[model samples]
Target: MTADKKSITALIIDDDQMVADMLGQILQDAGLNTIITFDGKSAIKLYLDKKPDIIFSDFLMPEINGVMVLKAIKALNAKIPIVLFTGYYNQLMDELKGEIVKPDRILRKPFIQVEKIHDLIREFFPGYEIDA
Candidate 1:
């Protein structure tokens, strides 16, 4: 196992418990050690402690938003990968570039393709295996 994949921890930050749970399950199935948080601040703490290989965060949350979380995570660990799970795509990359950790990928909310998720994980950790 590649060190990055084996160390591939993912944090899902969203206010909706269901969304977080759903993404967490998907990430787990993709062979990642997953952590789900409800807000950016908590996600920041989790990211700092876990130093996860990737993060999937909701763009808009009741409290701290994904942008803030991204900034915090980048400030702590610039190399860690983050994905913004969003329904609102307008100005997403442009607006977030300076404020948060630029996500390697954008996963639309309620993603229809699990394979795409798998692809993202694979993209980050090329040697990791995915179960059929």
Candidate 2:
């Protein structure tokens, strides 16, 4: 299903406040509403409560990590596109291999580009334009 720009909501989970805020701003600029969370424990609750159109979660976090968060969300809604962002990309991917709940995309921390984020939104919501 194609989501219109105004109707799409993005859930951004990151232990670091700066990263979460930056990602939220990027999403908002792209015309998607965003909800930011600081931990996986709260991430799940927000996910269920908000039922965002898409999710972007940091791979490493206290209590529960991105993988765990992905599993929890998948258990509730398998169709939601969840992108896991981490600096330890190789190790995280190895751990996630053959998992029942896998991320739609794994973006490397310190390397993510605004264009890539915009591209992901376009992938899920075709015809939606990113603000210049």
Candidate 3:
């Protein structure tokens, strides 16, 4: 049997443990299973193997960077949503858009409101109810 949309999986890729932990907490609170990795290489491997419903990756990772991860994810044809997350969205989004805006969402770091990520997921995959 397949899992329901509300329980969709999410992959979080970043070298920072705090970022990964926070994202996982937010995603888990929203009812989705969360998978995490610290670099582009691992992100790509897990992405293909697990087939997550969405991915949120830090743009400035050391190895293979977010853009490279995005490229690899795109190549996988997983058709999953990808979010390019960065502390400096203005600096990177403009430069990277032509190369990789194909992502479902480009999010600025420090989230401001932690719930926003869940909100975005709710908006993107509507009709799925988030658990309380």
Runs in model 2 deviating more than 4 A are: none
Stretches > 4 Å off in candidate 3: 1-7
Comparing candidate 1 with candidate 2, which one achieves the higher TM-score?
2
Model 1: ten consecutive residues of lowest lDDT: 92-101
**Candidate 1 residues 68-121, lDDT tens each?**
777777777777787888887875666775553476678887786889888887
lDDT of 3 by residue, 1-76 (tens): 4447555999999999998898889888878898999999999889878988889999888969888888888877
- Assess candidate 1 and give its lDDT: 0.79
Sort by TM-score, best first: 2, 3, 1
Worst 10 residues of 2 by lDDT: 1-10
User: Native-vs-model 2 lDDT?
Assistant: 0.90
Global fold similarity of model 3 (TM-score): 0.88
How big is the positional error of residue 129 in model 2, measured in Å on the Cα after superposition? 1.4
